[model samples]
Target: MLVHKRVVRLNEKPRIRYGPMLIRDQERIANLNYIYNCNDIEALWMLRMKRAPFARLVQTFRSRGLLQDSIHTSVEEQVAMFLHVVGHNQRLRVVHNTFRRSMETISRYFKQVLYVVGELKGEMFKSPTGRTPTKIRTSPRWYPYFKINNIL
Candidate 1:
């Protein structure tokens, strides 16, 4: 029996489409608008934060020059990409689909926002005084049981 050989064709090249991609950017903006402007409930479901805090974060990123808009993606999109990945414990591929961004784009923005959040830690948190609060210290039920310094 003669063996059949598979023929390889080299004449046809793959076509790269640019028009839909440009349109996708426009759609991305619309999606972002819905996420931020719609309501706090949707924002909470997506970003794990309310609308006010999400807007404040984007504003802070802009005001401090911590992050800037790229030619195609805005700071808001970048932050949303980061938050969606982190807040929901999602992988890069999942966020890529949600934001219509490449994995590299999602990862890059994630890193940038993570660094900026680290920088904000000092302002966002205060050191504990290490002393029991007056309420707990003075309460008869919780005094010695919850005492920080005078535990018997």
Candidate 2:
């Protein structure tokens, strides 16, 4: 304990040089190339949706006048990052590493996409009506019971 306190020049922390993506301009360009040229399957693998559906979703967002490209990032990339994080249950740092973005960028865009998509999601989920649907009503097994209900 005495030696630890007496140690000199130990307080100067080493300068950390971040590797690859986070530090270079070229890496950011490559990130664009990745999603832009990636095939449907690859897009699905990374973003949890195929290229066509991804494009359509972006188009939907654009058409609604909700989201737009930022100075440093595009709407597509923003959405992709958002989807990748949520779809894979990843943390912000994971997304930052994968997307080659800073934590701030990842968080900002994630929130943006989340807010916009959440805003539009109301259309997908309608209020439940107090009625049995045609499928349930028509299906005897489902409406009445799936099993014998032996306990009852």
On TM-score, the candidate that comes out on top is 1
Candidate 2, residues 1-152, lDDT tens digits: the string is 87776574477676798786545667767876898689988887888989888888898888888899878888889888999998899999988877778999999888999999789888746886756667876787797762344234
Q: Rate the local accuracy (lDDT) of all candidates.
A: 0.84, 0.82
Cα deviation at 6, candidate 1, in Å, is 15
Q: What is the TM-score of each candidate against the true structure?
A: 0.70, 0.66
lDDT of 1 by residue, 1-152 (tens): 12322222334465776565668877777888899787888889999989898888899989999999999778888888888888999999988887888888888889999999999999867998877889988899998777657653
Model 2 off-target regions past 4 Å? 1-23, 125-152
Error of 2 at 96 (Å): 0.7
Q: In angstroms, how far off is 74's CA in candidate 2?
A: 0.3
